[model samples]
Target: MRIEVNGTPRDIAAATVADALSELGWGEARVATALNGDFLPAASRPMQALRDGDRLEVLAPMQGG
Candidate 1:
C-alpha cells in the first residue's frame, strides 16, 4: 500500500500503525505519529490503521537540552 509518510510517498505493507512503524525500522521509543493530521496517543498505537493518501507524520525526538 502507498501512503504519504511525513509528506513523502512510500510503499509499505502494514495492516496497523504499529506494523507501519516496524516496517519503517523505527522503535516505539524514538518516534511519534499523527495520522491524517490527528495526534495519536502512544497507547493507541496498536489500534491505528493507515489508509491510502493518509498523511502519517513521524516526529522524532530531538536531544538538546
Candidate 2:
C-alpha cells in the first residue's frame, strides 16, 4: 500500500502504525506520530490501522542549547 510519510510518498506492507514504523526503520526510535492530522499515542500505535492515501507524520525530538 502507498501512503504519505512526512509529505513523501512511500510504499509499505504494514497494516498498522506499529508495523509501519518498524518497516520504516523507526521501531525503536523515540518519535511523535500523527495520522491524518490526529495525534497517535504510543500505546495506540499497535492498534492504529493504516490505509492507502493516508498521511502519516513522524517527528523526532531535537536537542539544542
Best by TM-score: 2
Task: List residue ranges in candidate 2 displaced over 4 A.
Answer: none
List the global CA lDDT of all models: 0.83, 0.98
Give per-residue CA lDDT, model 2, range 1-65, as digits (tens). 99999999999999999999999999999999999999999999999999999999999999998
* Candidate 1 lDDT, 5-64, residue by residue in tens: 888999998978888888888755567789999888777978887787777888988988
Q: Looking at candidate 1, what is the lDDT of residue 48?
A: 84
List residue ranges in candidate 1 displaced over 4 A.
Answer: none
TM-score of each: 0.87, 0.98
Model 2 global lDDT (CA atoms, 0 to 1): 0.98
Cα-lDDT of candidate 1: 0.83
